[model samples]
Target chain A: MRGHFNYLRPDCVTECLDMLDQYGNETAILAGGTDVMISLRTGVKKPRIILDISRLPETRQVEPYGETVRVGSTLTYSELIDHPVIRQEFPALCAAMGCVGSLQIRNVGTLGGNIANSSPAADSIPPMMLRDAEIIIQKKGSSRIQKLEKLIVGAYSNTLEPNELITGIILTKIKKGYRESYQRIGRRKSLSIARINAAILGRLNDSGVIEDARISVGSVAPSPMRMTNVESHLKGRKPELKTILEASRMIAQEIIDLVGVRHSTEYKQPAIAGLALKCLEDVFLDSSVN
Target chain B: MNLEIDFCLNGSEIRLSIKPWETALDVLRNQSGLTGVKEGCGIGECGACTIIIDGKAVNSCLILAAQLDGRKVETVEGLEVDGKMHFIQQAFLDKGAVQCGFCTPGMLMSAKALLDKVENPSTDKIVEAMTGNLCRCAGYVQILEAVREATCMKAPLNKDDVTNS
Candidate 1:
């Protein structure tokens, strides 16, 4: 808060994109202001100009596009939770968003802000990855799309340019055979960052055999990543209790191999396994039996 | 850099020239003279700075004054109309929900936001809405009772019983 900065509020997305082009690295896009305000007050980020794009109409739309649902970058967590398309097709994403801060925080925090902040403990990223989410990045005149996994390179880092803005996120609709669950372990029930979280989406065939499995875990590595190895192990297998327990163990082992042993490994190893098992069971075992 | 922001604060349209670094909490408390909004934590973790912005309860500490452009902001000060206490305030007083009284303003705002959306919220809905506001005095039982009481009230207490004090 020590530095003096000019604030610009653009009413439309094109005007905001023009401001970003004019200022480049000297400007920071302010969406939701949940993360940017804290960084500004703590002197962690000092930009000469702040382009407030939270109110841009083009970046606030939540609608269906062909076979996928598109969420505007400025759409808040509350909006996402209440959107009909999101509630019906992406329950895992809804569950992940519900675990974010408190009601007050959710009222102002946006999914794009959560993605751009790129916290490894971000509750939304794991489920977003499960849906094969893609980010649409916009510059002044042109825009490009990139897979969500590729957009985020590491912890608190992404490939976005200084003059670029995230317009929206595209998530493929969950089909009929797919079952999903999101589970997280936090220090407390509310307003705590996740210690370990998992998002599982599996497609079951007529005989209850796994046709496809997609699993993603957060806070276990430098970034939230899809567990392809575990997914491969679970595919074509029955989602019985024993099979899920073994697949859960594989998820834990995958984390160890990726992040290696750390001081909190003893607790996290079992916790990750248990969380993954719970998510899988919630989606596959519980739903199928009912 | 000073910027002029025009917004509706507690049913009044006001314009203020404030520094871009000033938060909504600072503007409300220092400039607007609305001390009902407290700042327990400068960060967004605590809901002591809760205010209703466009019918949503948000932490004022996390919102910059510049972001209030053309928006409607309601605080605990706006709860009463024509010198009469809002039913929620009356219920809080009757139920003895205030102990230290630090978190009451924020708690009232959160409760009002919930009631505005749902005429009769379930117990789970009430708890979820009130989770953000933390009362260190451990008066949650009475606070819950006050919200429930406010939901069932037939009429306001009196026209002159409660003032802006």
Candidate 2:
């Protein structure tokens, strides 16, 4: 807000990278503007150059790369949800994206923007984490791939350098028999940020035993974390009500131990457990029961 | 520095010089005199500044004026054709959905965006589309009724008419 800023819209990724390399220290990349616009108004980020990379074709492609899918970083939530691959293969991600903001927000909010903003409560991260997502970060000359969990250091913080831009997110495809669910508890049903949310992916063997499980919960710690402890407990166990309830309790306890006690702990503890129960139940029970 | 941008607004090509920090909402209401684009929450929380860009509804408050270049934008001011109320506007009137009138424009634009894509959207789809626009007067039931009526209206509210640009 202090200095006069230049709004530059680069036509391609290379041009964007070139501009970023030159003005890396004094630029703010604009993707969807859902988060960047808010920061600009609050004076949280004052940059000499507002780099508009929202329209680059290189960052908007959703192509299948062998076994995994590479989602262009700038693809909006609405666009991603509409893709047939996402709707058929990643229902948990679809639900998470649907839960974000609303239709208006989803129309413009990008998966890359959500990750770049690095909010602790970002709904997309938990689901992306469930799929073992990796980001492709590119600068002027070189690029690197990093795990999504490693990229986000803390609440609203990330390891992205000034010149680095997230170009694409690669998510492993779920094989046959895997069921996934995303559960969120917010202050309201619409346009509310997630207070506590979770994504659970589980698979049952032919014998009806939990063969594999992955759990990631958001808005509980510094960033959304994989509940490796609870996920390990669920593996090889019968997907029974008692087991689900016990696993849910373990997740609650794990978060409490990780975050320590706080004024909101009394509410968040039970809420987190309840969301876990719902997500687990959704993954393991809903289809069979129906 | 003021940057020159050209885009289609309400079926007409418009050229404007906008600053880097100027939002689409600010440019629409202040420079273009499109008061229908209201500014409720400077943030994206309130959908009062909702507008359709390139056939999708978005918070104009969150979009920079420079982003509007080479894009098609539609607002409530464009809902009337030949000075006649659009079918959606007629439905709102018949359903008595107007209470305070502040949120109506946003709601109508949201409805138009949905109807532009889906001819007769389901009830769940209607709720999903309009959830971003908040009516503090609690005029939701009537608003929903208006959208439902708009879908059932005999008037041919096709996509071509709404996407006039």
Candidate 3:
């Protein structure tokens, strides 16, 4: 942060990729700068070039491709919250984005930035993981798609190369009968970093049995992760209060097993379970289990 | 490295040579001489540096000055025309929303941004819009009242008023 860096704003994707190709390692890709600006000030990230890709036309659109929708990397949270298709189709994702920051932060913060920054407490990740998000990344000549869960490695870390630019996040549309819910435990409602958050997408068959389930939890782990065991347990279950209670406890147990006992484990164990219970009830019971 | 960034500020087209690290908050307060944009928390946590960019309220401190290039920027100064306070400002006075006044400019800009978009915002909408801006004086009740009152008055004529004036 002490040294001076060149500011580069490329209007098109080709130019952006070319710039990244040459000055990848020495450059910091700035999408919203909600996270990067702080790092720049604190000397956490000192790059030779500050690449401003917020205005690239290629990464500023939301286009539908068959059953999936491609959300541009730089599209702000406010834009996603107001989008008709996102609102109607992906209400859980919309709610997660709405819980990000206040209106001001939402107006500028982007989903791509959230994933790239890869904060464990990012609210958007849980809900996006519910839809099975895939990130489209590109450099100069070639591009590759990575699953959202695979991209983020740990807290504030990602596997993305310096030359790689996240172009868009493609998410599958939630089909009929699927009920998705995002629940978070924060210190306060506004501008509070989520202590523990969970997103559950469940579909019940005609006989009131859970046919499919997807559960992703955040803030408790190094990165937001899917509870595959809990999801598998939920499938074909009756989604009754007893089943949900057991599944919620399993979520905490799963985390305890992965992260092992920590200083906050006693508090976070029940907290994460309670959060998962709320999300599960929202998805399965469609009302408060209490 | 310094770069010339062009953007519309408070209805006027201007350009300035800004360093790469300088934020929009820095450019607005230092280069443009608009001290109204306050910086409470340099991070995005506090909304004291809130400003409207391309019709959306954003934390100016979180935005690089170069990001404002080719975008329309609005600050508290834009709310006044010919020394007459905008209706939103008038509502603040009528409702006594200002206490210590450090968070007033940010609050006013957040309110203006909301009123500009939604014709008649509900209480929840106002709360959502102003949640970013923290009034340390605990003047939120009065501020919310002022924004509510502003919604009842002329329906945000400041944009046109600024142009006409």
User: TM-scores of all models?
Assistant: 0.96, 0.97, 0.96
lDDT string, candidate 2, B13-79, tens digits: 9899989788899899999999999889878887989999999999999999999999999999999
List model 3 lDDT by residue over A160-204, tens digit each.
998889999999998988889998989889899899988999898
Model 2 chain B scores worst on lDDT over the 10 consecutive residues at B154-163
The interface root-mean-square deviation of each model, in the order shown, is: 1.2, 2.0, 1.4
Off by over 4 Å in 2: A1-4, A287-290, B154-165
lDDT of 3 at A28: 92
In model 2, what lDDT does residue B42 have? 74
Any runs in candidate 3 off by more than 4 Å, and if so which? A1-3, A287-290, B156-165
Q: Candidate 1 lDDT, tens digit per residue, A205-264?
A: 888888889999998888899999889988898888999999999999889978989898
For model 2, name the residue pairs that clash: none
Instruction: Evaluate every candidate with DockQ and list the scores.
Output: 0.69, 0.68, 0.75
Q: Kindly provide the TM-score obtained by chain B of candidate 1 when compared with the true chain B.
A: 0.92
Best by lDDT: 2
Poorest 10 consecutive residues of model 1 chain A by lDDT?
Answer: A1-10
Once model 1 is optimally superposed onto the true structure by TM-score, how far is the C-alpha of residue B102 displaced, in angstroms? 0.9
Give the candidate order by descending DockQ: 3, 1, 2
Off by over 4 Å in 1: B154-165
